[model samples]
Target: MSVLSEYYAALERLKANKPIILPKGSAINNDTVAMEAGRKRGSIKKSRHAALIEAIEQAAQATGQNVPSPAQRIEQAKTKTKAVKSDYEQLKEDYEKLLEKVNSLLLENFELKQKRI
Candidate 1:
């Protein structure tokens, strides 16, 4: 099998907890994936096997054994920031409306007091 295909197979096996080369229940990581594919530890370099690395990372994330990829995390942060900005805008609008109402009430109270005096 091609080297890339071997890595893919190893990734699947690792995800399934049935690594052929490594001991059973080995955690899915770049090193373990490489070793399971009959490669040296640290063989899965991003410069050479970016797709394989992405696949392994996604698998690890799916299994809840690793955090989301950097791209995924950035997208999540952007979404959360957008929501927070929207909420802040809405709150500012509400605050401005309430301030106007309070100012109008205070003015009306002052006028009443002046007339009474």
Candidate 2:
């Protein structure tokens, strides 16, 4: 089969969640479609296959396959990391406060025992 036909078939298979080569529930993007078509990951280049690329993009949009770009993924990761760090800091503060309270209670208990001796 021609490369274009192969890609289109792969796209259909992906849309139907029945790809032969890729895992089930694979996202409908250029790379997944290319790999499903038995081609390399970056085989569907815009310079070489502009129409195919456009078709894949349109299909992905139509099917609601909104895969994030690398930059978008990185930004999402950064936001998650920031939130995690903030939570960690809050936990650390709470731990320190608890530790201080425990120490104070221990000291008071020791003083009480000494007075009863």
- Candidate 1 lDDT over residue span 1-117, tens digit each: 899999999999998888778998788889999899999998899999998888888898888886666899899999999999999999999999999999999999999999999
TM-score of 2: 0.58
lDDT of 2 by residue, 1-117 (tens): 888899999999988889999999888888999999999999898899898888888888888977677799999999999999999999999999999999999999999999999
Best by TM-score: 2
Report clash pairs, candidate 2.
none
- Report, for every candidate in turn, its global Cα lDDT versus the true structure: 0.91, 0.91
- Residue 99 displacement in candidate 1 (angstroms): 71
TM-score, one value per model: 0.56, 0.58
